[model samples]
Target: MTYWQMRLALLRHPISAALAAVNQSGLFVVAIMGTALPAVFFLILLNFGILLDATQPSPSRLPILLHLILLQLLLIGLMRDAILGSKARLLLISVPGHQADHKVSMLLATLVNPLLWPPLFILLSTSPTNWPLMGAQWLLPVLLLGIQWSGLFAPAPSLVYLSLIFLLSLLPLSQPMATWLLSEQGMITLLLMLLLCQKLPIRTLFNRLQRLLSHLPLPVSSYIAQSVIRQELHGLVLRLTLALMIVAAGHLVQTQVAQFSGEVQTLTVSLLAVIAASWQLPLNRFLSAKREFLLSLPQSKICRATLLGQPLLLGLLLFQFWLHHGEHCWLQIGLLIMQISLIQIVTIRAERQFVLASLISTCAAMVLFVTLAN
Candidate 1:
């Protein structure tokens, strides 16, 4: 096959396509830049401080190297989705070709990915002396990256293997003592661990573990619903998690910091609104496909269960803050309620206008509430 056709075919694979899409949309670009820029900038400033102190040179270099390696590990590990990998493998199987050719094509397709290079460059630039050694070190990350890609397209058994290896690697990394010891072996050990974790067998293990867990005696319907909710609320979960962490940290500064309280509430409410608004378009498509299913259900049940569940999720978030602070901020609660209500109402009445109206109303409400509360 021609090069463009091969590239297109790889992209069509589930795992590769998602990665490519994530890379193309500049989400990965933004995330990497967001992470790397501040890190590098701050490291530069810190390096100057270390330069003035000649006594602790080794400590500084070691910590800097360790930190950079950790950052790369975090970025790659978190962003590698097994679902995407499975999808890619399916496409590979369907294509008529020599298996080796497909593997080579898949490898080359990864080269076009913006995600791979930026972090590699970051790693290289951060430790130029380590560059020559990185070929050896890179064996792990490259292997893991490739294995993750392979696992996506591989069979269930293969996914199980990959997952098991990942878990085993992670188990050691989790212990404080192990982590410190591993770091002492320096960049080479870290790179090897990364590569070993990336192998196809590891991914297969992971897939198998997931399948086992999924078959557990849980309420299948409820579990399915929750899975949907979690998938849809992924972005909101990250925002909430970060906001809660910040608010918890701020508690140390002052028990009754009005500034922290207001900032936390406003941010929490705004993020929920953004998340609710985002669901509008997707929900429309979902509802269109399942019009009959939705229609068969009682309006009251739908309103109470599905519709109210959306707001209640936001409410629970606000309630969490209230419980922590021990303050009945009616105004904050009202803003959150209104934000959720406004999004739902706009979504039902004018699906097309939901995005713009959601933004305008949420911003306006936040501004007014913050103004009056302060």
Candidate 2:
């Protein structure tokens, strides 16, 4: 493919797959939104309070700057696979000028990021007075992309760069400096300056880190599981964040709402269990992609199960702690575990048809929740 064609393909493939997944799991989407929407609203209201408080003239830029960093980090994580995946690596090796092309394509892709731009525009709309600060925030994802590249190519420099940025943000800037920092043109200049400061051989540093990791003595199952988690660490982190949000929200509601129904609390616990176990989707996808190769190895089944079970077991322990006060907590826990285990198994067998499997699993979980609540 030509460079443009390759870029288009890279950009279009994920969108197409996401649409297909969405079409396959309309019910899944509804279920997730239903479970997550209340907590999401709570977060928005909470953040709105903070936003109102921070909207003063000469507001402390730290929180807004920190918000920029958080949003950029999330954007980088969501797009990491596309930006640095196997296809990108292959393109870099095979296509002339692919280094520049790939970087440009990834940057262009981030332009449409649901996680990054929407919130930014929303913030801009809400806080029109802080337009300059919002303008400065636009360059952050670019800066973060550079940091991601640095981490991939030169880990040490990336750390230094992050520390420097953090320190600079903490320092009090004079009015002129602050104005310049918040200006789009000046922020771009600053970004370029910082990029120039990181003079390190990225590949050499990354290879060294790889060599160091290679020597770690881990059990086979642990090593394999860790590898999968590392590969999809960003997505896993987001899932964990969502899971935590659900648990926290649920806990808050349970403690504060005297009129909270037992059925709703039980359903919340059930949803928490499902969310925790949903890590299996990515894990199973990874394993299923390598299924033939893995099946050829001795004791592969044990390794696969161990890879799948470890997270579930840990999640179960957490659920037990969280639910110890509930009526028939053990029974609820047992049903939740069974529902999650069933979902995981079904997802594994469904192979590349993960979306369909997810829909089925979601339906199964809802049924289990209803039964338990009754």
**Which predicted model would earn the best TM-score?**
2
Q: Report the C-alpha lDDT of model 1 over 207-274, residue by residue, as the tens digit.
A: 89879977888543344345456565534433333333233333322333565666655654555454
Candidate 2 overall lDDT versus native: 0.56
What is the TM-score of each predicted model, taking all chains together?
Answer: 0.48, 0.50
lDDT by candidate, in order shown = 0.46, 0.56
Tell me model 1's lDDT, rounded to 2 decimals: 0.46
The runs of at least 3 residues in candidate 2 whose Cα sits more than 4 Å from the true structure, single-residue gaps closed, are: 1-9, 19-52, 55-74, 80-103, 106-110, 118-217, 226-272, 281-305, 313-342, 345-374
Which 10 consecutive positions of candidate 2 have the poorest summed lDDT?
A: 51-60
lDDT tens digits by residue: candidate 2, 311-344: 5775675465345325656666776677667656
Q: What is the lDDT of residue 9 in candidate 2?
A: 68
